[model samples]
Structure formats: structure tokens, C-alpha cells
Target: MSAPLLEVRDLHKSYQLKGRPALEILHGIDLQLPAGECRPICGRSGAGKSTLLHILGGLENPDRGEILWKGESTRGWDRSRWAIWRRKAVGFVFQSYHLIPELTVEENIRLPAMLAGVPLEESWEDLLDEVGMTLRRDHLPAELSGGEQQRVAVARALVLEPELILADEPTGNLDGASASAVLDLLVKMVRQRQKSLLLVTHDETVAGRVGTPLRIADGRLAGNRS
Candidate 1:
């Protein structure tokens, strides 16, 4: 493939397990995510899937590696630089749906734009329609269901027209039906928007739906290179 939209190299992380030796979380993880590809990086519970996602999203730092976004190295980036990178190039979705309780659907969707100093436009409203949440645009997070909240979250992530989206268990909080719907909507948005997606999930079924799975086992990519 062409130069990846995001490249993770030699990533390593560890945490102190209470009363035990430092527990390693990630071991030399290297993954390349190209533009317009929606791929799942999966592992069982406690397999460091979220860690990898967090590092890739710039929410956390890796101990020993570099992340290249659009061929620019992030290793030397200060917090401010990382923040700017996140606002412009990276979007994130969490399992908890992270919607602001005080904001309406449209307000929540526009949050990223506000952070990036870009005003929301009519096209963003069209994004709400595309995500099947146009009717809930005026509703608050508390007024919406889990699936509805997730839809808004997805729209929020897309508002900045980010090149890459890092979603950590996007469907973990929803039911089977809701999960299916959310996954379908997310995949559609990724394809239609031509944005790359790195989805972190524990469910093989969920992982299978997006793309080929890169399994993480014992803090390493299990049997897969990238």
C-alpha cells in the first residue's frame, strides 16, 4: 500500500500490577493503517486492545515506539502538538458513548468543530441525516437511547472530516441488535466518507464484520504481522 495514514512501530507498554512485577501490556506492536480502510484490531478482555487504540489516538503515550501520522513522526510531539493533531487528523469514539449530558445532539456533533475553530455548516446537518439521527438532532444525550447516543458520537467524530477514526469497543454497551445497527452505520460512514478506521473490540463477531482481524495475544500481535 501507499504510505500509511497511520503507522505504529515497536510499541511497548506496561503497568504496575499491584504487588507484582510491572505487567507488560503491549509488546512491540506494529500496525499500519492505510487511508479508506476499516480494520479491526481485536483481542480478548485484558489483551491490551484499548491500550493500543489509546496510543494510536494520541490519548496516551507509548513507552518505546513511534507513531507516524501522514508520514510525520509523533514521537517528538509535545502535548500541544498531539492535541492539534487530534483536532485535525484523528477522531475518537469510546465504548461509553462520551456524549455531553448538557448538549443537544447537534451541539455534541459540533463540539469537535468548535474545538478546531471551524463553524458547523449545512453539510454537518446532512451528516446527522446520514447517521440516521436527524430526528434526534434537538434531543439531549439523556433523551436518547444508547444506540442514538452512539450515532451522535459517530457524527461527532466525523464532524472534523478526520482522516482516521479510533473507536474503542464502539458497540460494547449496546445490545445485539443495537450493536449490529451501529456497526453497519459506522462501516457505511467509513466507506462513504473514505476515512480510515481502527476499531478495537473483543468480540470476534464484531471484529469480523469490519475487516480482517489482527488479534492481540499476551501483549503481542498473535500470528499476524500488521
Candidate 2:
């Protein structure tokens, strides 16, 4: 069998308060995500779900243990190396959508690809079509609906053709119908591209839609479920 796309071992993280001891958020987490698979990490607030996702996405580091991308350890990689890896190997989607309000949908979607040195004209058209944002390509984020904004975010995330996508509550800000639409598109994209996805969400129905569902409680991953 081939190696997993991502492996995390003994991952731990903590933050120190001004007048008290350090508050440990994650405790010895171990996870393995195979290539092209989709997994959901479900948990309530303060469960360290977002923290875990950030660590896995290379946006943050664990105080202890390591994250292995493909087969290489991320421990010794410097900031620049991490940035390269993040750009080339991973894509991230967040609850807030985080789009620059001033930029048009197409411009926001093309930003990541441009940063990665991919010509804007090369992938923008195809991505806009894929995410059903072709009509709103030139619309600013403020002019679009929540679902539209998220569609643009998805397009941006995929512009780099990353091997793994870490989405932290990608649909959290949308209404029921809009959230469902966003999730459907996200799942379809992941499956079609054969990219691994790890999503952290509080919605049970959303978690159930993934290939595998795992819960986080008290800083530990619960048993996997179908």
C-alpha cells in the first residue's frame, strides 16, 4: 500500500495565559489521511478543532510532535520552506471566506495561483466555470451572496491544484440551502480532483457527508465512523 498523504503523530499544542499556567489545547493527537479521501473532524467550540486544522495546514506549528507531508517530516522546514509547501501542497478554506472585499470574485480566486506564479489567465476561466461563478467573476465580494463568496473561495483554493485541502467550517456562515450547495460543490471538487480533504465542522449532517467522520472531544480524536 502507498503511504498516506498526511500523517500526524503525538501532536500537542498549548498557550500560556498571562497569570496562569499554560492551557493545553491538543494532547498527543495521531491521524493519518490517505490521498484523495475526505474526512470530517466534528467538534464543539474550544475543542481544538480549528487549532488542529491550522497545524495540519502548516499555518501553525505544534509544540510537540510532527506533521509528515507525503513522506517528509515538516519539523526542520523553515518558514520559507513551509510557505512553499503550503502553496504547492495544501489549500485552505475558512469559515469567514476571508475574501478581500475590494477585489472582484475573479481577482480573489486568481490571487493564490498568481502568488504561485501561475498566470491569471491560465486557470481563472476554468476555475470560475467549475465553481459556477462565471457570471459573477467581475463582481466584488460585497456584491455577492455568502454562497457566491464561498464558491469563489473554493475556486481560489483549487487554483494551485493542491494535493490536500484543509477546510475549517467552510459552510458555517451560510444559510441551510446555501451551506448545502457549498458543501456539495466542495465534495464534488475533492472527488473529481482526487485531493485529500480534512474539514473541521460543527454540523453533524455535514460531517456525515464525508467519507469518514471522526469526532474530537477533550483534545482527542474519537473512534472513526462510517
Candidate 3:
């Protein structure tokens, strides 16, 4: 068996709503993932699935726990450290197509590498071709359909070739057909890239196709082990 690429131990998180007690979201979440493994998480609305994804992606902090990336702890990582880690190791996709409307599809896809101060990858064109958006490369987000935009988002997520992808409801906003297409594209891309995927979604059909199905409730996962 291979070693885990990422691991979380005894993770806990909570939030304080105004005038209310601290509401715990995650309760001692322990997870592990090997290279190229896809882990699908399903939960109802407000089930803390997104919270776990955000924490795993380094976009949010855990109140208490340990996140180990290749056996090294991220306990006290500063913003710079987190930024570097994100640029080099993590890719994130969201329910919303967060493309910059001002940028062309090509530009939007290249933004991560640009921000990371890295030159465009040699595989840049390959990614564009993979997403079947080479013809729309110069079009702005507004010019594309919802599915096209999501295809672009998936391409952008893979542009940096990050080792791990955290997708939170990537198909939520799309219609049935568009969601199916996007979901298929995402799964195909992840498998082709050999990247680890931790997907948070509510759709059973999508979950059934992505990876091993695991349920999340109150921020804890069931039917999932490592």
C-alpha cells in the first residue's frame, strides 16, 4: 500500500453566530488520502460538507486539529505558507463559476499560474484542448454557457497541475444536462490527471459517478475510512 499524501487527525471546527453559542461544525474528523484517490462526500444543505472542504483546502482554519501534507503538519502555517501550498499543491473548484468576467477564457485559465509567478505550463494548450474550449479561448465568461464556463473552471483548476483537488458542489448551479456534463468532465479530468479529489456534493447521481460515496453530517463522515 502507498503512503497517504494528505491526512487529517482529530480535526474540529466551530463558528460563533451572533448572539449564540459556538456551534460546532466538525467533530474530530480524521481522514487520509493516497495519491490519485478520489473521495466523494455527500451531505444535505447546511451539513458542514463545505466547511470540511474549505478547511482541507486551506481556505479556512480549523479550530483544533492537525492537517498533515505528506506527513508534515500545517498547524502554524502563515498566510504566505498557505498561499505557497495552495499554488503548488492544491486546486479548488466551487459551486459558483468564479471566473473573472473581464478576462478571456484563456486568461482566466492562466490566472493561477500568473499569480503564482510561474510561467505558463508546457501543458497549457493540452489543458485547453482537454476541456474542448480552444475555440472559445478568447471569449469572456459572459459569452459562454453555464456548462462551458464550468468546463473552463475545471480546466483552470487543472492548469497548475496541483496534486489535490477540492471541489465543493461543482455541479450544483447547473441544470441537469449541464451538471451531468460538468461532472463527467471533472471526473475524467481528475482520473486523467491522476490527482486526488475530495468532492463535496449533494447529488446522488453525481456522487455515484465520482468516487466512493461517503456521507457527511454535522461535519463528520460516515461510511468512509481513511
TM-score of each: 0.95, 0.96, 0.96
Full candidate order by lDDT, most accurate first: 3, 1, 2
In order of TM-score, best first, we have 2, 3, 1
Residue pairs with colliding backbones in model 1 are: none
Report every candidate's CA lDDT: 0.88, 0.88, 0.89
Candidate 2 C-alpha lDDT tens digits along 12-57: 9998899999999999888989898899999998999999998887
Best by lDDT: 3
- lDDT per residue (tens digit) for residues 1-226 in model 3: 6468999998999999999999988998888888898988888988889899888888899999999998888987998899899989988899888999999999999999889888985789989998899999999999999889999999999898999989999999999988998898898899988999999888877888887788888678787554
Q: Which stretches of candidate 2 lie over 4 Å from their true place?
A: 120-123
Residue 72, candidate 3: Cα error in Å is 1.1
Clashes of each: 0, 0, 0
Worst 10 residues of 1 by lDDT: 217-226
Worst lDDT window (10 residues) for model 2? 118-127
Candidate 3's displacement at residue 74, Å, is: 0.9
The window of 10 residues in a row where model 3 has the poorest summed lDDT is: 217-226
RMSD (Cα, Å) of model 1: 1.5
Stretches of model 3 off by over 4 angstroms after superposition: 224-226
